[model samples]
Target: MSSIKYLSAILILVGLSTCGAKNLQEQNTLQQTAVQLTDKTTPVVNKNTATPKEEEEEAIALPPKAPLPSKKDSTTAETFNHSRWDRILQKHVSNSGEVNYDALRNDPSELNIYIDALTHNTPTDAWTKEAILAYWINAYNALTIDLILKNYPVKSIKGIKNPWDQKLWQFGDTWQDLNTIEHKILRPMKEPRIHFAIVCASISCPKLQNKAFTASTLEIQLTQATKEFLNDPTKNELTKDAVQLSRIFKWFKKDFEITGSLIQFLNQYTDFEISESAKANYKDYNWNLNN
Candidate 1:
């Protein structure tokens, strides 16, 4: 009976130990559960957080646009009107820069009005230098057109003997021929680009501008004409060792040399390189009518 009492006492001690172990384990489980709950409840923030609309607004900003330049603002000649010349050109010349010679000849009366305007007008201090230049240009072209009409059904301007020498029109107080207008006035002005602006009604000449050149647009017009003339492969052939230039360039080399050498003047307007050694020769000029 004493041995049985000892065994029971031992069993009771083991049960107490088990209960303590269970309690310790439960305390450890509660700590783990608490740590999980704290992690779930805590909030995480993004450093670059923004609303969708705000992000879109920032991405869509537009820069301010610049204003277009006005032609009228550049115009300094106050009272000179080129609307008549403009009208004549619009009626006779095609968009491709071809003259409708047949139509112009059919209605001689229309062209007479243009000549009348040129005759009555004279360059004065009231006009800007730009306007004066434009006036003479228009006068030259108008007189050329009248001369061709007077001798229409002709193959070339050269067909008429001494076309350039013959005094054809009255300019202000004097009778001026093509040679006088070109060599005496335009050449003396010291702008080589005028060679391109003044068309001779020939295939070799720089294409006649379809619109009248005005003082306001003269700067742009001259630039455009020079570029066009240089780029025409038929007129100017640029190569590695040589430049087959138009007869005009050979005739007016002096004018081109005023500012710089002939090659330098050419390189200014040409896209392709004209080497220093490239010698210039006259390309056969096609003097056929440009009608």
Candidate 2:
């Protein structure tokens, strides 16, 4: 009887141990299932992906289609008046190239009139290349100022959404934006000097000239603009053997290089000669508003 009782006790202990092991196995399986379900339901985000704003900017940065002259437009060379733009620039822009947005915003009638005139008077085949270039350059700068006025109190131009991409002006039947004016229209003209003449309302950009660019004065204006920009110590640190240039040179190096090497191009405007093997470094561009 004693032996049977002892055997019964041992079997009971074995049964309890087996039950506990089975429970632990089931618990582990349940935990694994929970983890798998979470993995399937949870969304994963890749940190390297571009945000919506960046994607939009990338799309806008692409070269736009060049505007063609209207078939109905006359071929007779026509000149667009720039006196209105001249007045606006003179009144608002200071000697240092800073703009007085506060004052301009108060009286925008002149700006409105000029923009309207530009909208109606698109360049035609008859327009001289100089006239067209001048028109677009003035149009670009004026429109940029208008954009700033429309969204006044902004710290920087980039703070505004789609500043370059907004189709705020019309040239003939085609709608245009700042990008179209600079990239498709001006850049294809192969006059790299346009880079200096067209200001993006940034600190490092060529100082906004007080006078408007005109067809008759376009050549002088471009030359002067280039020289002034290169000589501006703030924009370019020039030396005989080494030079630190504005970011514009790096961004538009190809534009400047079309006719010759960058060093050669700089020689045309730089006061001192830069060595052919001179080390070149670019200054960080300040995107702050020119105001």
Candidate 3:
């Protein structure tokens, strides 16, 4: 009886050890599974990220170089009244091109009305070259003023984010910003005189005429603008053999050179003659608000 009892006790001890070992293995497996699950569910974060503006710019595809042709019947300068814009300019803009942003902002009814009217009118090929040119010129200036008023009290237009690139308004079916109107449409037209015609709300830019550019007066306006810009001693200091021209000349040198030499283009408008061998240097542009 003593030998049988000893063997039974040993077998019982072995069974308990085996059970404990199995339990330990199961516990380890479950722990490993939990760890895997935690890793799978948790997300790692990155410290460096793009800004909202940067992300938005990245997401936008480039617009077409020029606006698409309008399908509607083309309108003439008479049908499209720019007198409203002319009135606004007369009311608020000074002879020297300083704007009353505070006053305009307070009473924006006229500006809003003009912009609404402008949006309804878009140019087509059926329109005369002069009429189309006048339309775009007025469009650019009016839009620029609208943009400034929308973000008034700012020191300079440059202070506004993406001032030139923001497509805040639509022309025809296409959305247009300042850059598109100036570079894509106006520049491609190969009328270098437009450099002076379109005013950027900056001190160094050509003076904003206090009257609208109409098809009938388009030639006169463009000529007057260019002559006034070049002769304005503040903008351009001219001599027979040397010239300190506005940065406009430097920026759009190619545009001016299309038909002839830079001197030739300047001579057409400059009060004094500019020699072929005249040295050209650009003035430092003032980005201060033309207010």
* Model 1 residue 100 distance off true place after TM-score fit, in angstroms: 1.2
All candidates' lDDT scores?
A: 0.83, 0.90, 0.87
lDDT head-to-head 2 vs 3, winner: 2
Error of 3 at 115 (Å): 1.0
Off by over 4 Å in 2: 1-76
RMSD (CA, angstroms), candidate 1: 17.1
- Model 1 lDDT tens row, 186-277: 78988888899888888898888888888889999999989988888988878767988998998988999997898988888877778888
Candidate numbers sorted by lDDT from highest down: 2, 3, 1
Q: Which candidate leads the pack in lDDT?
A: 2
Instruction: List, residue by residue over 117-187, the lDDT tens digit for candidate 2.
Output: 99998887778889889999999999999999889989889999989999977767888999989999999
Q: Write the per-residue lDDT of candidate 3 for residues 1-291, one digit (tens) a residue.
A: 999999999999999999999999999999999999998994443436767766566557556477654644435324467998999999999998888888899999998888877787887556777888888898899899889988888899999999999999976688889999998999999999888889999999998999999888888899999989988988999999899989888888999999889999889986677789999898999999898
**Alpha-carbon shift of residue 15 in model 3 (angstroms):** 99
State the weakest 10-residue window (summed lDDT) of model 2.
69-78
The residue pairs that clash in candidate 1, if any, are: none
